[model samples]
Target chain A: MILWNIWLTQDYFEKQNTILTYSAVISKAYQKEEVISYEKWSECQNYYTNPENLDFLYSIPVTLAILALREFSDDISRRTET
Target chain B: MSIETIAKAIGSILQDTYSRNYGLSKGFNLMEKEIALSSYHLLMRYADNDEDKNEIIATMIHMLSAPFSDHEIDKITQYVREIFFKQYPDEAKRVWLALIKYSNYKKANPSFYRYQDEDSLNKAEENEEKFVQQISSDKNLTLDLSEISLEKSEAYLLARAFVITPYDTDDKDFSNFLNHILPIVIGDLTKVEDYSYNRTRESRKFHHESISDIEQYLANLFLEANFENSKSIFTTLVNSLSGNAQRQRFGRDDLFEFVSTTLDYFVLKLYDNGNLKIDP
Candidate 1:
């Protein structure tokens, strides 16, 4: 049940913040002009293995996602008022 | 009764309830059936134990006012057990494997806006089509390759090079042009180590080892090619660069920029003006 709830939350977060989450994953694994090596790929995957690691990876994207969603809501509300 | 017995009974009841609520009057609706299966799977995943699953099933049977016969309970338990323990786990593993394949493919083809969600991906594709149409369809669109990035210029040149008309890929000189001279012209051979698993790595090494006077060799190869439409432009390019190569004025980046821009302009003219007019 605990695992299921965690998976559901993760899935929900993914649907809501597709760009943010994916960009975070890509940025964590790659940099411009540098090859994405197997070592970098493993490092990104390892972050999802534990709660502490997952928290570290999610922090930035989650913050940005909330800001983006809030901005979208504001834009919609403004358009509706007009 | 065994755990399987209760699960089977519950699974049947769940299926019947789904059919009553979501099934079309004429036949089974595939979309609704999919939703039902996914909902049932989610419920099973959440239950986390046989007892929890069986209790849910028993409660549902009681609420629905359905006859909870012993045989019926046994059959539902069996079906639920098979799905939870066997089928769903296999599906999850299949999904995991596909994700790995997709991740690796993305690493190989690195692009800024290419890796996106479905809507954005479609938008990106549409934008690409618009760009191609704008460039390919317009006859008077004069593109100054200098103003644009090296990537776009390279793409234009390569796109023209790959065309079958006038330039035959099966020809030895054309093959030489692509395999040997093009890398020197493009100036990316030095950064071949930074390419993650590209097919051109071995060919790059071969080109580097075999070619000594790369600039002169590239110019000679271009002149040697019997270009049906752009021979005069190719000759002019060779003539213009020969002095610079002799004086050693052009560096790798300078050579790449000049060659790529010149070729980009040639191809753009081919599409824009519908004629490869010789520049005086």
Candidate 2:
């Protein structure tokens, strides 16, 4: 039960954070470039803001990270406890 | 219970639960055993082309493998239609009209069911093609390799080169250093989404002592050299130097050589001139 709870919490955090991080990283990278004018930035931002694109980008990392973290944490805990 | 009954029961339970979850429906199971036998009987009663039979079977299998719910599948279908129809209206319209006619045919005759009758098969192929085209055409989607700042680009490139090299260090310090630096440099280059400073803080724990040792050495060297504002000089030196790339490149012999050469040059400039003194 303790293991399950940890798994759940970590899964939630990873999914929420990865999406936040991905968007933040993309925005920051765009900001770094001088050639991407504010108007162009807004246009690109609007494009990515579409629900399908946002969900697609967000879901990939969330699902991958959750699977990886769950397996890794389970293995570690099993070793330590046994 | 008998073995056949027991096996059937287990299979039924699995089918009810994870079979759908894992994209294995009854049709899929049947199709897997004998490719397009069911579909060919229903869809191509008048047609007898071996290649078409194989193609339809392949498309059916591909659709069955996709992980999507009924609702999500509908959304995907619509999204594909919009993208393809907008971009290549002529071809897209032909495919769209064919799909509509196909859908009507399937709806009108329940007995005419086949693997090829599924709209999802064609929709998946269309979606895959559109995705490839979008990735190829969109310039913004392409990674910007030349945009990296010159001062930091070499360090970033060197860190990448360091990752491919083997390490001999048993000390946790070296492992910790590589773990810390590699991500930051790669993250910067790849426009990776996370740049939280917390990862850096965690990595610093491994080399905290070594960094302090270096800082103390520099402080003493500056003091003995009678450099004015020795404290400020030490602070400036520490501030001006970044450990992110250094730690990433830590275990490489080439990196070790670079650091040694750079340090030797600095020492020669300061101490060989009799400007600095080191107490034994």
Best by TM-score: 1
DockQ of every candidate structure? 0.01, 0.01
Where does candidate 1 chain B have its weakest 10-residue lDDT segment?
B159-168
Candidate 1 local Cα displacement, residue B230, angstroms: 12
Over B201-232, each residue of candidate 1 has an lDDT whose tens digit, in order, gives 33232232112223323333343345652354
Q: Which stretches of candidate 2 lie over 4 Å from their true place?
A: A1-20, A23-82, B1-19, B22-74, B77-81, B104-280
How well does model 1 score by local distance difference test?
Answer: 0.36
- Deviation (Å) of A25 in candidate 2: 2.7
lDDT of 2 by residue, A1-82 (tens): 9999999999878766755665554434433432333343334344444544444334222222222222333442333212
For model 2, state the Cα shift of residue B119 in Å: 24
Cα lDDT tens digits for candidate 2, B24-111: 4432223112111112222222224544333333332223223334444333333333343344333323232223223223223322
> Chain A TM-score per candidate?
0.28, 0.34
Runs off by more than 4 Å, candidate 1: A1-82, B1-113, B147-186, B197-280
Chain B only, TM-score of each candidate:
0.26, 0.19
TM-score, second chain, candidate 2: 0.19
